[model samples]
Target: MPTITISLVLTFATPPSVGAGGASGTLADKVVARNAHGEFIIPASQVKGKLRHACEQMLRGRVPLCNPPRAEQMCPQIDKDDAGNALPQKDGLPCCVLCQIFGSAGYPSRLRFHDLVVTDADLLPPETLRAMVSLNRRRRVAEAQRLFLIETAPYFNGLQFQNSEAITGQVDQPSHIHIVLAGLQLLFAWGGGTSHGLGWGDVKWEAWLDGQLINKIDSEEVKQICLS
Candidate 1:
């Protein structure tokens, strides 16, 4: 029988993909450039909370389950405090019975039960010579490499992403986030992201990653012009 996979359903009423970096453009230009929907597939590092929590069980080879907040719980309250301030819910609050299980396989309505994987070994391709070496560059992995493989697909929110084109963002947003110059384009000209110097794993890889990422963001101007 299949493992007792856990799941929670929540709807995300997100504004369509905005822009990335500090880019500015028409909304029409933003949508295709940003690929707001595509980013979710290769999500950023933020949604690993529940995954980390359930990881203990997953590591022990048990049926790891996930849970998170309800859609309603995600809503902010309009009521003000004594100082005429709004009573904001604590950040990181669980959205539901499984809210605490952010990475436990909730949100992302596309997820389903069969997507759970109780073991990690199934992800690697027999841990061969080359693959093992490549993964070792990072040496330490808080979680499995195939953290979001299809076997576990439809489990998490299927990957949620924040388009760089959004009007505002976290205080220390990466510089690449809002730039017009693309790393991907640069990598092509500069021998794939780097010229092989400094630090672990050729600077080439680092350069490639940096350039490729910024080239991907959209401009808030696009969302404003098209979406508004």
Candidate 2:
């Protein structure tokens, strides 16, 4: 049940004006919108679609890399409208949709909704596992919806319980933080997963995670129906 809050910081607001000879603008001004410690939402329909498609790709034994490859691993072409100037997405397509469940329709590129001030939704991963597990259970979606309301909650998944693992520049912890270090190293490293891999590590990790999901859902009738 490894989970992280995934406090995304992607901005989607408009960029700033250019100075003399296309110099530059402040990074913040250039950014359209960004949230470092905030939560965003995606339409239920979208999440369901993305998850199922990606999961199926994973099940098919291929890593599901998002289109465009670099920007977003899920949504594609988030630039502009048919006439330019960011198009109003259907219920905020590119941005995650969970944030609007609490009333964020008017907060462009903002979604602090689904308040977790007194809940465990954070720790439990915003019902991903559960949502994926219970689409068409033993009863109507209406019934399942109610039960979900009862069970849905916010939780702190961060490692706050343990003494914060401070790196003293040694052991398992490195002294310096390298940006995209993990991503770059694993981008094409042909190695097995954590279990063991000389040059097969990256692919092995992908394959292992892919195998785990289906195995986890082995007892899920809802998953079977949904994915079917």
Candidate 3:
């Protein structure tokens, strides 16, 4: 089994709105995900979602479950129609690579991520209050008067996990873990406002096997396997 430790220096490029579902305070619209510890944290679920999407992009049609004959119905690539019914794939299968590793409807993901916790609370960026408005299509001007505050960590350090269970699964496969780490670099944003370009981070990955460090992301082997 390999224990993967990722050190991330996340520099928020834009305001992120992970959304606590509702808003409060004088500004009253700001929402973000926070931990019971009262610190902003990125959940493991979020990381998993990002990794899955990144894998899809990097692997393209290579994932068995994502490819035709198997993905037609089960793949996330398939979208719902106007009536809200899901369209079928031309050829679908029981599972894709994502399903195999991360699990799907019937399976459980082999990969696990520990929630990313902020290292220094004081280092977190101060919350920013901004005026919210919608664009008017007719006049192309800002409309509607809404105020919200967004708590964002413009710069901070955090820790996350990528554990590879040795006995229960096949971590011995070279392509399996290598491909996964590569997918991390492909992740662009976390939380919300991603479409508007926010939450980008520089992540450095390291791997340990049996209590001994085995790989650093910058290593030549990793460069060839992951970066290339």
Candidate 4:
């Protein structure tokens, strides 16, 4: 199993909402995911979903990736009649590139994401994890029934992929490595509220096999692959 260690500096363009999986808090209505250390973190599942979507968009030639990569997954291209009545997709099959990596309904995902922990070496106070309040627009005021709180992470963090089989077929390892690297740099977003403007980050990738830094991914390499 080959492993890729990735480093990222995340600057939230807007408030992010990576759901905490429950509404157990006494004060805030919702919370962001955190570790036992009380540090804000993004779970591996979130990372996988974002990357899978990016792969589907770039490889499948769709603007936004499909939900389940199925027939119901909204296609960007629209069909219409002479009268301008929209038509549904006639084919009921999913044949996207994500099926090869993340797997389809019955297949298993080839990549594994390790939880990305925020490396806030500044040792800032735990209270820095800001809690924001939201109110309803219809009421013209903040009401208890419509009020909610969202927690946001700090500025910078580190991310990693513990293990992934970049190449499953019988070919040179370098070819398979490039395929996975391109997916990493496909300009993806993480956590929730991305559509609402949040979690904007870029990755500087480094790979290791048997404890050796073999290669670094550059823009030129990615361009060459896209051209090919």
Candidate 5:
């Protein structure tokens, strides 16, 4: 297996409410996800899902891929026996390239994403609370009793993870690494509330393969391959 290390810095241009899964025990209706250390952190799952979505959108018309979130539509589709036992994938059946890299229910992913954390505690801005209300679509008015407070982390220059804490993964083929890089390049906005202009940010990243810096990735070439 070939090893890949990715270092990413995410800088939010506006206050973001990435949500801590749910309310913060009466503190706010929604809060930013954080690690046990109480420092704000973007979960690895979120990052991976976003990247997968970006890649899926890019490859949709160019290649064969299963529409996800629908088990029946996903690749490497499994079968079941009369006894309700899950059957293994047929030997000759192949999964889509995105599934090959991001994995599906029965397949394991080759790439691993790490939580993006604040690069420096001192650089963190103060957290703020904002009151928001839901709108009634029919009447185009604010709905009563729908007012809530959302906790947001102030905008910052960069939040990153590097060195031993960097994102680490293994690839079955060298070209798969380029696919992952191209996906990362496609990611711009992140987290929740993007439709309302929250969680808007940019990502700057560097990757290394087997301790050797990867200076460039020809995303155009990867697109061409997908088209073929």
Candidate 6:
């Protein structure tokens, strides 16, 4: 098994409202996700989902991928026998590249994603609140009594995890490392409100294979992989 250690530095140009469901006695209707220590964090699922989307978009035309978020079109589509019993996967169906890395039903992911956290508590800025209004699509106007307050994490520079707290995961196949890096490079925006200009940020990452730091993969290398 090859282990990959990744350090992700997220620099937010605008405050992000990475919500935690509905309000829980908080001042706003929506609040940012936080850890038990009350430190802001980006969930592993969110990071994985965004990266999967990026990979899918990049490989759409060049490779075959099952349509995700749609069960009927998922990779390694389940088959049935004459009696409607599910057939075993050894029957020749193979998962798409995206599913190989990110996983699908009955298939475990080749790579794992850890929650991205800020290691330095002092770097965290004060949380802020923003008011937004829901729109009436048909009438093209603000819906009456639709005003809501959402809590957002303040903008910060080089917010990252360091040392043991770094974003790390193990990959069953070392060859899949480049694909993961390419997807990371393609990812620019995260969290919610991206269209509204929130959660817009750049990612800086370093990868280590086994226990040794590898030569940094550059944008050119990523481009080649994406095009290949």
Q: What does the lDDT read for residue 67 in candidate 2?
A: 32
Candidate 4, residue 60: lDDT: 42
In TM-score terms, candidate 1 sits at: 0.16
Instruction: Name the candidate, 2 or 3, with the larger lDDT value.
Output: 3
Instruction: Work out how many backbone clashes candidate 1 has.
Output: 32
Q: Can you write out model 4's per-residue Cα lDDT over 13-84, one digit (the tens) per residue?
A: 444556553467434444567768766666767666666666555544322133464534423232332244
* Order of models, best lDDT first: 5, 6, 3, 4, 1, 2
What range of 10 consecutive residues in model 3 has the weakest lDDT sum? 159-168
TM-score of 4: 0.57
Question: Residue 83, candidate 1: how far off, in angstroms?
Answer: 20
Better of 1 and 3 by lDDT: 3
lDDT for each residue of candidate 3 in 169-210, tens digit (9 for 90 to 100): 334234455566677778767775555454555555555433
All-Cα superposition RMSD per candidate: 20.8, 24.3, 7.4, 7.6, 5.1, 5.3
CA deviation > 4 Å runs, candidate 3? 1-15, 23-30, 67-72, 75-93, 145-149, 153-172, 209-228
TM-score for candidate 6: 0.77
- lDDT tens string, model 2, 108-207? 3221111111112244344211222234456546443433211111223221111111111111111011111122122321111112211111211110
lDDT of 1 at 34: 17
Candidate 1 per-residue lDDT, tens place, 69-107, comes to 333323231223224433222253322211222222223
Return the lDDT, model 6, position 62. 57
What lDDT does the true structure give each of the candidates?
Answer: 0.22, 0.22, 0.51, 0.48, 0.72, 0.69
Clashes of each: 32, 29, 7, 0, 0, 0
Tens digits of lDDT, candidate 5, 82-152: 24333323245656777777888757886778888766768776887778788899999999998877777
TM-score per candidate, chains pooled: 0.16, 0.17, 0.64, 0.57, 0.82, 0.77
Task: Highest TM-score: give the candidate number.
Answer: 5
